[model samples]
Target: MKHLTILVPDAQTSLNTFACIIGAYDIFTRANQHWVGQGKDPVFTVCLAGVSENAVIQQDIMSIRPEFRLSQVAGTNLILIPAISLDFERPEGGNIELTGWIREQYNKGAEVASMCSGGLMLASTGLLDGKSCSIHWNAVDKLKNLFPRVLVKTERLITDAEGIYTNGGGYSFLNLVLYLVEKYYNRETAIYCSKIYQIEIDRQNQSAFTIFTGQKAHGDEVIRKAQAFIEDHFREKISVQDLSTRFAVGRRNFDRRFIKATGNTPVEYVQRVKVESAKKSLESTRKTISEVMYEVGYADVKAFREVFRRITGMSPLEYKNKYNKEGADLAAMS
Candidate 1:
């Protein structure tokens, strides 16, 4: 219920990810309207400044400049770095002026937080010298080598720290913001905010005890194409040869890349996705199991039922009963 300004790197910058975060949180707050300037309850005022950087590590990007910069930021309860490209060479050397401004605000009692590479900018400010922070797993080694004084904690997300907070990566970025809203507002507010925006917030921490479950391997463009194709054709039986030809990659290379990047082979991943789609259908639709199965890539009822049982540990009918039925046994678990 307090107005806040998110100072983004100036315009002409490559990507305004943080500004998007500001806009997203504002929308998530259910503040009655898109936050305009200087309103009574301005949940977020995006200050788009110059100094563009890489949006993601998927490509080799050249940093750009912005048309405006933060003249002065004060009286805000929080400062957030959505993402910053802090590299191995002189990681703490770049972004001097911006980091200094953040430090000045934090000294004035504002809580500083960053998501993904944004922690690099915060680390450059020395705010995380003795503090613990979570960073994108890919940059774990570089970050540690760059800043030995900082205590790096790798997990789903990190917060409730004394002076700062950090999240693991882009997906966890939403979790970080939701956690902030929940801390200042309430759990209901956070949930309502997510629901109103139709954002599938991170309900469970992905970086849990399952070792190698989330250990991110190197990025691969071939796998990206396969994923795109899978998302597009979940209703049909997608073939490995078809994907290989469509993406202009060999079947072996495509399979290797997909498995390396997503931690699941193409076939296995598709099977899981098909089952998930069927689960939603069972919950939200009045269709028969055979129809739902065909709708989600499986044509045989028995095969779909078997996959569902193996993955969810429940048959189709049992899952539907537990989910759609009122006060079904193990309803709490459902």
Candidate 2:
């Protein structure tokens, strides 16, 4: 049987962390039971392993205690890291031994998977260096800042690189769990669990759920002013040249600084601001796609649709249909 060790982190973790740990354990255990019920041997031996035997994580009003400590596990086929708190500095500072242990396990040929913000912990192991990783979209900027060597794919729902798996934000980690089920078991078993847990299988991206709040924490006064200008006039035709001239910076220098600070080009930033505005209108107002597009200063229908889909993984209409309750209700009746 494959040995699956879910790391019970000894740090201030989010409430979702507990859910991810219990949820994964329950699903994997169910998978084993399903196999046993089918006259087959169980596939995995699952256990929750922590840094220390006495480690107890308290979040809000609840507590979690792992069944085994990391030192006791001589070897394991797989290691799972669940979402921890977003105050990554605190966890990284406190969980030095945990990260070191994860590194050792990975070096010993064990597969590691991180759920949601757990990517921060896995990335700390240096196993994800130069490898693609997906985390909660909201934490993308922070992860990028902390681990510049790691390729953070904010759009992907799941990233599998050389046995290191990472997933997107929130309860979307359930999708990654289902993916692990299919990988370790079979498609039939994965489908069975998906039905049992009511999780939508084969979700490939988390872009639709992302709210494009631009990264402004970088201390670049000029870039910050430029960002504010873009946000203030997103409904106007703002060009890179115009922005550069207005800011009194050279074109190349402006582009470089903008990208370094915001992780987006001036044009890209402008598009995102406009699209975000359009999204709000679509969600809250009784407006046609054309009206919303024009309101966001998108004169070209094709251009607007393409950019919207590229950023959000959904067309304007699809986004509206998904997020706008009134529109969905009307469509249902129609």
Candidate 3:
């Protein structure tokens, strides 16, 4: 049987963290039960392991006591890290011992997976260094700033590189668990759990859910000015050459500085700003996709659709149908 340890973090955590822990345990255990019901032996030995005997969460609203402390588990086949509160300034959240233990387990040939913001803890262990990791979109900028060595894939729902798995924000972690279930057990078992939990299987991207708030925390006055200008005039046909000239900087020099400060090229920043504005219009107004596109300064329908899909993983019409209740109702009526 594969030994699967769900880590109960030794830090103040959100209700989301509690849900991930309980949810993972319930799903994996149920997978075993399902196998047993089929007259087959259990596939996993699941346990809740922790650095401390009990960890209080969410201002002591609840406490979790692990089945075994980290010290007690000399080794395991798999270690799952649940989401904990992420202080971007201190991504580790003072869980030094926990990170160390995780690194040790991983070095001992155990697979590690982190759910949502739990990628912060997993990244802290240095296991994700030079590896692709999926994290909550909200934390992408912070993760990039803190762990420059780690390749952060904000659009991906799940990233599996060398046995270290990570998933995107919130309840999307359920999808990652389903993926592991399929890998560790069988596709049939994963499908059974997915049905029981009502989780959509094979969800590959979280880009549709991301709200692109441009990164502006850097210490570059010129770049900040450029960003504000783009945001303020996203509806205008703003070109990089125009921006560079207006800012009194050479084109190549401006491009280098913009990318260094904002992690986006000048053209990408302009596209993101325009797309973000288009998204809001589609969500709140009774505008057609073409109207929204034109309002955001895109005259070409095909080009607008391409950029929208590239950034959001959904077409403008699809995004509207998903987020605009009135639009969805109108479509249903039609």
Candidate 3, residue 264: CA error in Å? 0.8
| TM-score attained by model 1 | 0.51
- lDDT tens per residue, model 3, 269-331: 989888888988999999998888889999999999999999999999889999999999989
Better of 1 and 2 by lDDT: 2
User: Candidate order by lDDT, highest to lowest?
Assistant: 2, 3, 1
Clashing pairs in 2: none
Q: TM-score for every candidate vs. truth?
A: 0.51, 0.98, 0.96
Model 1 clash count equals 9
Best by TM-score: 2
Residues 56-99, model 2: lDDT tens digits: 88876898898988888999998999998898853543478788
Clashing pairs in 3: none
> lDDT of model 3 at residue 70?
81
Candidate 1 residues 1-334, lDDT tens each?
A: 4434344543212243543355444654453342322244545543434223432112244332332344544356777776755442443322455677788878888887787777776787888988887887666656776687888775446655785778776556777777767665557666776786666565433332112222233467667767767877878778888888988889898888777577568887777777777777777666767788878877777788787876665788877775655324445666
Q: Which ranges of candidate 3 are over 4 A from the true structure?
A: 58-60, 88-94
Task: Please give the TM-score that candidate 2 achieves against the real structure.
Answer: 0.98
The CA lDDT of each predicted structure is 0.62, 0.91, 0.88
